[model samples]
Target: MAKKNVLIIGAGGVAQVVAHKVAQSAAEFGALHIANRTQSKADAIIQTLRDKGHRMPFASHALDAMDPAAVEALIRQLDAGIVINVGTAFINMTVLEGCIRAGAAYIDTAIHEDPARICETPPWYGNYEWKRRDDVAKAGITAILGAGFDPGVVNAYARLAEDEYFDKIDSIDIVDINAGSHGRWFATNFDPEINFREFTGTVYSWQGGEWRENRMFEVGREWDLPVVGKQKAYLSGHDEVHSLSARYPDADVRFWMGFGDHYINVFTVLQKLGLLSEQPVRTAEGLEVVPLKVVKAVLPDPASLAPDYTGKTCIGDLVKGSLDGKPGEVFIYNVADHKQAFEEVGSQGISYTAGVPPVAAAILVARGTWDVKKMANVEDLPARPFLELLGRMGLPTRVIDATGDHPI
Candidate 1:
């Protein structure tokens, strides 16, 4: 059978990585098309592909992803079988609607976050994406949410633990530690506004059939990881915990992120001056401005960090449970290198880690191994294939079992 055509949305750093990987695995996909709000950015990533001598047939277009009608029209035009959305979090619903209307599978890295709100309440998926679940089911389209690293692979870790190692999972601690550095004084590795907004809101976690909320940095601890040992990570609100809470209501779910002293200090100082607020306020000249927006305007774009990025990132799920009626716990994780990712995909380790998985999902959708005809999350699919794909794609998974750490 001929492979299905794919349309990749967005032209950011993650989108660049996705395009390269999709090109590398073009045999698994038919035509690979890309679209973005800015035509030049889309063309630029395609240019990289041409430089690499990619054999895949490629095309680029200008798109306003906020418009469902236009997006659906483009999908019909391309006859796309899968839409890989690595765009800004703001345009998720429109693109998903487009995919549903076009009768194509959909995949994305993170949950949709409204530009107006810093953070919504607990169960963030229900706020916007989940309401479309019934419509997706009615249309019989596969909509996979949060297919990125934390929300993406971490979800897979939880499923792997539940399926292979545990009889009854007691607790899950999702940890993301990036020991890599960009050699910059002060900057966020992702969108500055989005990064700051994530922490400024309530940190919600589900434990023992109850929800707990705390302020950012209010709870923190030190963890000794595989390569980057003894780093301090704080319990923070994250995208995966929201959906995991719904899936495993009985299991405790929480997320922690590693941060250095410099980042914390800078973030604290910016926040104290009200520069991180999403709300717009008047300046001395009476011009309306959102402080956080201004900060993002002045900060370095995350894509620029790749050239100077060095070190590694260790991310995984630590699951504690009963195995054959005996209490046990294990850490299932992947470690990525910045230099290796830059040489392979022209992106930093973080973006490489997040970008590669959704492309794997897209290829599986093309191959029919994961073309389930309904809305699903990464955890709802088999983990072995996904882990194997990552292993070949530069991010390999290793399990710390009772015997020792080794590849699965």
Candidate 2:
């Protein structure tokens, strides 16, 4: 099989991780091209690839992914076989449209988030990405959604339980615990604007075959993970629940994120001060500003946290159901160290966690193991292959069975 040409559209921390992973696994893909709003960032990523001695031909270009026509032109110019949209969540649909128009396979980490709106109602994918499903199918191009760690691998874990471990699936508690300390007073793991916007809206979950929404941090629980141990993670709205519910209608899909009190206090103060609102309000001096954007401008960039980042992050899916027609529960997860991730890929723990899996998906796509002829979510693909590929790519999955912890 010929290697597929791949083009990555973002140069952020997660995009850095993806670039390193892709460069390391260059055998799966042909020529590599990276495009970003800042061409220097893309060039720097390519430089890193060269410094690492990755045996691959690489190119970099300037791109405004917001312009679908521009992205389409770039894809056509590069003759890219696959378009990995690892950029901001806001640019998802536009990039996906470019992929469709250019006749290239498209994939992204999270569901689309309108820069104008923090968090919309439940089944968020239905609003933007899902609307293009028919178009993608008709165009005969594949679009994979939520191929990141939590939504990507965690979603796969749930499906794995359904395939190998469970007979009747019951509940899925997707827990993401980042015990890493970036040595910063306060900073998000990824884009600050996207990070704050995620928690500010109503937390949505699929429970008992219905949609349930709540205030952020309203439902909290302590989780004793493998390395992170006992940490408090609150039920929060996530991209996986929306797609997971569509696949496993009877199962309860919930997402919980670990956060410290210090972070909560800071978030609370910011929210109360109207610094977290997505709506733009004019200042007395006639400056129009979105509260969230203003706050994001002041906060530290998630990528900067890499060098001083310490500790590990444990993210997994706690799946409960029937295996032998009796109750059974298993936690399938991976623990990644910040230092190790930095040493290997020049990225932090969170970026490593969210970034690695999609490269595996890209490899699978190139290998013809995951190229479905339509738009789909992570669960829509075969979960085992993706998980197995991730095991070889620095992030290994372990399962907690009744007996003890073991490899998946």
Candidate 3:
């Protein structure tokens, strides 16, 4: 069989990390191709690789990721056996379809979203990605959904708990704390539009074998986590909670994200003023624009924050259950430094953390370790190899319990 190539479908910070990591592991792939709506962004990333002295064959292409035919055409033209989709959440379904049509293994870092919907319902995957499960199976293509940090590594953490630590899992609390500083007055860690859209809707959590809902910032808790120390996190609707609830229906699944006072205040004001609305409205001059898009345009690009970004991020799963009929709780997490990430990948810790895992997934697909010809989430696959590969690539996993914090 010919060596499979990887086609990365984005050119943002996360995509930059993916490109670099893929280049570093060049021997695992045939050729690398990156495509985006703007070709220049792809060129810049490839140039960075060139400056870094990476000798991998890389090319850039222009693509409207929302157009499935265009994405499929690029995949076929590149002879890509795998598509690592680090694009915005809105493009997930289109990219998956393209991958299916092109017979390329699919890996995405986030759940698919409808441009017009906000927090459609619990089990978000079922709302979009899961609907295409039959199509994926029939085509015999592997589609690994939500392959980023929280949805990716955290999902693996849950599976690890089931595989080793617990016999009957009870609750899974996924906490994401970005104690990192981007040195900005107010800017999102990723795309401003996606960041704002996540919080502008109802907060959903799975508990007591049922779906629960609340307002964003309505439930806040202070966690004294390792390295980063104590920080305030809010229960927020996220991609993982939906699929996790379905997989571990008996367990309580919730996602908490750290937020400082400044962010809460700014987000509150924006929501109240309707400045975060995704719907388009006409101005006095009859020029139509989405308020959310306007806000995104004014904020600093997330990728730009890599240079001066500092501090660390601690994201992990707090799993509570019974082990050998004894009550137990274990926190499986990884701490990443922004400066270290930028020095290594030319991106901030947030992007680095989110970006690395999909490449690992791609490697597994190439190696046939995770090339299950069907649709699945991170938790549905074997966790150890993926976690081990992540450790070698950049993000290593550590478990905290009565045994102490040690690498797994």
What are the TM-scores, per candidate, against the unseen true structure? 0.98, 0.98, 0.99
Instruction: Select the stronger candidate by TM-score from 2 and 3.
Output: 3
| Native-referenced Cα lDDT, model 1 | 0.91
TM-score of predicted structure 1: 0.98
lDDT for position 123 in model 1: 87
Clash-forming residue pairs, model 1? none
- Looking at model 1, residue 376 earns an lDDT score of 84
* Overall local distance difference test of candidate 3: 0.95
lDDT of 2 by residue, 1-408 (tens): 667899999999999999999999988889999999999999988888888888788999999999999999999999999999899999999999999999999989999988877678778889999999899999998889999997899989988888988989899999999998988888888888888888888899999899998999999999988988999999999889999999888999999999999999999999999998888899999999888888888889888889999999999999999977789899999999999999999899899988998899999888878889798898877888898889999999999999899998
Residue 115 CA error for candidate 2 (Å)? 1.8
What is the C-alpha RMSD, rounded to one decimal, of candidate 2? 1.1
Question: Any residue pairs clashing in model 3, and if so which?
Answer: none
The whole-model lDDT of each prediction reads: 0.91, 0.91, 0.95
Per-residue lDDT of 292-387 in model 3, one digit per residue for the tens?
999999999999999999999999999999988999999999999999999998999999999999999999999999999999999999999999
Number of backbone clashes in candidate 2: 0
